[model samples]
Target chain A: MNGLDPGPLLFFVFGWFFALNIKGITDRTYRQASRFVPMIGGSVTLRIMGWIWIFVGGTLLALDFLG
Target chain B: MGAGWGGGGIGYSITLAETQTPDGKTQIGILTSKSVHSAGADFGLSATAGKFYSNADDIGQLEGKGLDKGGSAKFGLGLYGNHQTEVGTTNSKGEGVNVIEYGLGAGLGAEIGGGYSDAKSRWQTEIGSDKK
Candidate 1:
């Protein structure tokens, strides 16, 4: 019930999401010569996941602050 | 933390982790470079601790968890210190370089990590940059 407790949770979640998105992007680019269609799908999927993280993190922080 | 996508000299990493229970505790993370670059890998570790926002009434929280390429580039050992708070995060890192081949350098960085203060401080010295 302390004020700072949520900070770390938020950090961990964001870190996880950030790392995942980066990995997806790097992988798609690396395989560009072999597969072109899959790269598009991969990029879209990564973007969606990145947005999801932002939304979830923002919502949690807002709720925490509001209460 | 940030995610970037590009071509040529690009690097990426992903980690999925979970810990049972809930208690605000410090978590540490380590990163080291690989053979891709002759400058060698860069190693770093960081610690984080805070509370849970999900259950506002709940107390205690716990959690834990870069780049570029080539040319004359640079290489050395470094040390960093960082702190994170609701306001923001501040970090500084320092390292050393040898001018033409090696020397010394240091750097500091600060950013907001999920509303938590984050910072890193480091110092690095070029151990062996003239081996070529």
Candidate 2:
């Protein structure tokens, strides 16, 4: 709790939400968002993206704390 | 193009996209989207009614896919807005989607749009160039 930037924390939370795979939220986001590749399954793509966000957030948080 | 088991469909869209540069320089271009779904099959077409900001793009598309029971034709309207700011560009746009669905085994819809592009272009030009 070094009072570091909270941006990474916010990303972590959003990542968790996406990884949770709430059906309605996933569906609506899939319908509305502009995807880099539209042919992929929305659920699968979102899950992968969520994990990436989690990883990025965690790494940044760790860096903030260590630095 | 896309496919699904229980419900799925394929959709394609084309848009005349407007790209903006910092200090608000803008150019018109094109964007295309092709998608395939494997859940809840349906066929639909969407057209852009209006748009603003960096994305003042007009889009139109026709798509179909679905293997189900009874089929029906449907219509829908959607409004959307997007804004983006980066080092090189900052943009904002408001747009609408008009959809019409026509389903063979499932359901289908279609959309049509017009009359907004000209106004958007003029407005973008004025705001980007700081003209009155």
Candidate 3:
């Protein structure tokens, strides 16, 4: 257990959260970001961010265990 | 909307955002901040340039903040759905302080950051909050 590195797993979960475009996350982000950059406060951008996170997390997981 | 990088404390980021206002308006304008520094005091400025979704032009912004012994400053900017850059720091002992951060994209993504202080170094997620 001591050797566990949680970074990859955490990233994966965050990716899923974003990719899913959960209302709670999108709503909060839109509410806050819309104040400055109104365009970015949409669901599309959030979903993109989520997919990226998932890809990065998956890559990290692969490296951690395979390498 | 944009991308950038710099090393002060040490940080990097990747971002992407919308190009027009939510209502599909083009915007163009300059958003700036009022800088004030004082001991034991905190100050900040925030502004959004562009006409909203009702006008035509591009939109973007810049912002940041810092502290000196007992003072602080913060600023923010956005454009093109909005490109934004922010910075912040604190010097409790009145010694020299260095802090820098850069983010890209019209929306949030990921950032790697860390800083050295008090004879020690530590890693941390980017810091700061959007105005409510």
> Taking the candidates in order, what DockQ does each have?
0.02, 0.02, 0.08
Tell me the tens digit of each residue's lDDT in model 3 across B14-111.
Answer: 12222243444433322212222211112111111222221211223211332212111111222222211223332233333332223223343222
Task: Indicate the worst ten consecutive residues by lDDT in candidate 1 chain B.
Answer: B96-105
Error of 2 at A38 (Å): 5.5
lDDT of 1 by residue, B35-127 (tens): 122232232112211121221111111111112222211111122222212121112112111001111111111111111212221111222
TM-score for all models, in order of appearance: 0.22, 0.29, 0.36
lDDT of 3 by residue, A1-67 (tens): 4544454465577667667866577456555655654343355665665676677556646655774
Q: Compose the digit string of candidate 2's lDDT tens values, residues A1-67.
A: 5556454565566666666765655445556543422333444555554565566556656756675
Ordered list by TM-score, greatest first = 3, 2, 1
Per-residue lDDT of candidate 1, residues A1-67 (tens digit): 6753343345446545443656554244324522422222333333444454455445445545665
The best candidate by TM-score is: 3
Q: Give per-residue CA lDDT, model 2, range B1-132, as digits (tens).
A: 011122345433233345444455555533333333333323342223234333322221111211222222222223222222222221234333222222221112322221111111111122245555
Q: Among all windows of ten consecutive residues in candidate 2 chain B, which has the lowest summed lDDT? A: B114-123
